[model samples]
Target chain A: MLIDWFTVVAQAINFLILVWLLKRFLYQPILDAIDAREQRIAQTLAEADAKKAAARLERDEFERKNRELDEQRQSMVSRMQDEVSGLRQKLLDDAQSAAERLQTKWHVNLQRQQQRLGEGISRRVQDEVFSITRKTILDLADDDLEASIINVFIGRLRQLDGEALANFVQALTAAEAAVRIRSAFELTDEQQTAIRQVLREIFPADAAVRFDCEPELIAGIELTAGGRRVAWSIEDYLKTLKDSLGDLVREQDSSQGTPTAESESLA
Target chain B: MQLSPDEQVFWQYGFIKLNATIVYTWGLMLVMALGSRFITRQLSTEHTRSRWQNLLEIIVTGIVKQMKEVGLSEPQRYLGFLGTLFLFIAVASLFTIFPGYQPPTGSLSTTAALALCVLVAVPLFGIQEQGVAGYLGSYIKPTILMLPFNLMSEVSRTLALAIRLFGNMMSGAMIVGILLAITPFVFPVVMTLLGLLTGMVQAYIFSILAAVYIAAATQGHQANPDLATNAPKAHSQTNGISHG
Candidate 1:
């Protein structure tokens, strides 16, 4: 068979029609669907990426805030610790000051008690010495001790200074021209006469010596003339010694920063 | 059995003849068109797809991908021509495994018509891409003496394509026919299977050659500038794989 020109023309036209049909119904739609799917996937991925970035930023912010809170908590804790430490120090200082104050008050009270005890002992010693000396003098002396006491009284009158002599003379010149003499025992008449002779010589206007027995005088004598008195008692000397010893004790307590009381009693 | 389906005359008018070649070609075209429409009617882009949808997408994307690999950067622009050429020849050879069917591609007229389409398409695409003067100027390259040589090469290659496809398809059918008389059963079945393999090969070769031609024509198309740079290397692979 030869080449069929009519069939060739027909086949070519058929192929072109087939090409147009396939293009219209097959290739175009599939390609469009594929393109659409690709675009959707890309958009979803972009949204996912944006969400991931936002999550990361939020996480970072949370971490930063947590760190700040931690710092604040630490600062508060440290400040509280410092305050507690300061309070502890103040309490310790208050305790120490209280202990020292109690100690100082106790020491002062102790020193006062000690000074009072020393004063009591000194008084008791003076009283015991006076009693012993008075008893010994009464045992040793008989009639002479009283005479000696009278003689000592008269002697004291004769030894009076210018002011005393005038005072006595002025008193003797008055209507009461007598001097009283006190003794631990009764005086002899001779003793009394001697005292009167001394007085008359000194005063020149009277010679009256009145004698009296006062056993409580404790082997001592006293003269009273013109409303003036002169005494020689062992109690006065004992009081002087007691006062000097008390002053010494007071001075020692003061130098040692102690507190004590000192008293002077008239004898 | 007739060598060309055109020998089967169905009706006639004065110098206007209707033949089996025209009939089968139209019937094949109708089947192709209707099947494609039905398969694409409810297409889905989801992960789950119909088997038919899967098959059609595979064929279409495979064709587009091959063209792209061969340096046709804009593959869909040439998809219609190249894809039709491949399906036509493949379907033609494959239908022969059935009884009472003769391939239209076994005829010289149909093969020549297909070759002529390729010849016409090469220039049309070239002219569209680089303009007429630039495409014509490709011939005068290196010297003016190459103009006739390039022309002769174009015509000669087109004829080679037509005759080569015609002879191979026709000879395979002829050999099976001769074997049918000599040994009726087993050898003919074997040869028929071999023919199927050969037919699929021819389809692949035809599509590849057409792609190669269009790739050369649109070589300087600057839509994808790197495609022009890589085209020659891709063209050499095409040359290596080219058969009728």
Candidate 2:
């Protein structure tokens, strides 16, 4: 067989050209797409990371604001509570002062009323005593010595209970030794004897008697003994003076409807 | 009998047969190698590495990766042998189109010598990676009873590789030659084209089988038992039955 060099060289050249064309058109493009896709993916990942960081920052800010607001609200509530408590204390103080003032006023009024009542009672007692003294001096003006003495004794006996009358009679008997008599007018022995007989009959046997007389007694016999005295005086005829004074006081009390005891005592 | 002068002279010298085939085929193979290298370099220059260099690197890397996957410990030590085997077979097939050339790989003596080199190198590689004791001990695992079968398989495998390459190439060449003598010219053209195709195919088959054999020998007794045990190594050895 003879060698064929031409055909072998031709085939080798054909295969080489085919390989170069396939590499240039096909493989390069596929590799470029792969690199470009990798770059785009990296960029997208970085963008997503940045967004997450921003979201986290915003959330932290919101949490911070929320915490501040909660603290502020707590402080505000506490301040309001303090103010309410202070207001409550003030109101309590005001109420206490008002109560004190009312209590003081009431006490003053009560003390004033008690003082007035005491003064009123004292005045009435003094008036009653004065009237009793006047009546006693007026009773002595009766004309008949024995009759008057008997009448006085009977009246005193009617006013006194049994124990008082006994005390009075005992007092008269004890003073009998000191008996004395005086008169502005001359007295006859028979009249004296008669007065003595009457006194002896009215008094107990051991009773002591004393007598005194003044012309100013106004035609009435006056008798005096120990601390007891009887007089018949023209002053007794002036009983209208006390009656008028009592009527005047009653009229004043009725007209003013009995002024408060404090006002009356002040007057 | 009266003879023509030309016929008498022709009969006296037998026939004028030229043995330019080997020279032409080797030349063609050199051209193919240069062409492959040039095309690869042109494509590779656009990138950081030349394509031929890159392809060479890829082949080395792929073999290494396969070796690692096959669990060989010292792939670099055996890489030269496998790489040479691949290139020789590839170039021989591609250049087989030259009219007078015959690939030395088609000869039994050459293939047997190659297979013997593989057989010898496998144990050496195994022993270098794993001591001699470990290499021998690998046959008996998971049991000692497997040692005999494991040893027999190793020897048979090398024989298979050698016989398969020789028988396939020799038969292809003989069939094409006989066809050419029977019908010259047009028929010879058909046979030549067929021979080219067959030559390339046989080269690829032989190389792949060599890889399988080397892989199995290094990987050990357990490697691909299903295909290795059932498949026939040569055409005459199989009773005219196709395994695939």
User: Evaluated with DockQ, which candidate comes out highest?
Assistant: 1
Instruction: Pick the TM-score winner.
Output: 1
| lDDT measured at residue A81 in model 1 versus the true structure, 0 to 100 | 96
Tens-digit lDDT track of model 2 for B1-244: 1110111121122333222323333454456455554544434322254555555556546655654544445655554455445445556555556564465555554456566666776777667655787677778876999889878977886777666655665555566567767876687677666656665555545544545555555555554564344233432233232111
Evaluate residue A23 in candidate 2 and report its C-alpha lDDT on the 0 to 100 scale: 34
True contacts kept of 1: 0.66
Clashing pairs in 1: none
Docking class of 1: medium
TM value for model 1: 0.72
Query: What digit string (tens of lDDT, one per residue) describes model 1 on residues A1-267?
Result: 557888888778888998899898788877776676678778778999999999899999999999999999999999999999999999988887777666666666776776677667766775677677767876876777666666666667777999977876776566474677887777777776776677667766645677788887766678777787766654456567667776876776577552222221110
Each prediction's DockQ against the real complex:
0.51, 0.02
- Model 1 bad stretches (over 4 Å): A88-232, A240-267, B15-17, B180-186, B220-244
Global Cα RMSD, each model: 7.6, 16.0
Error of 2 at A223 (Å): 78
Second chain TM-score per prediction? 0.89, 0.63
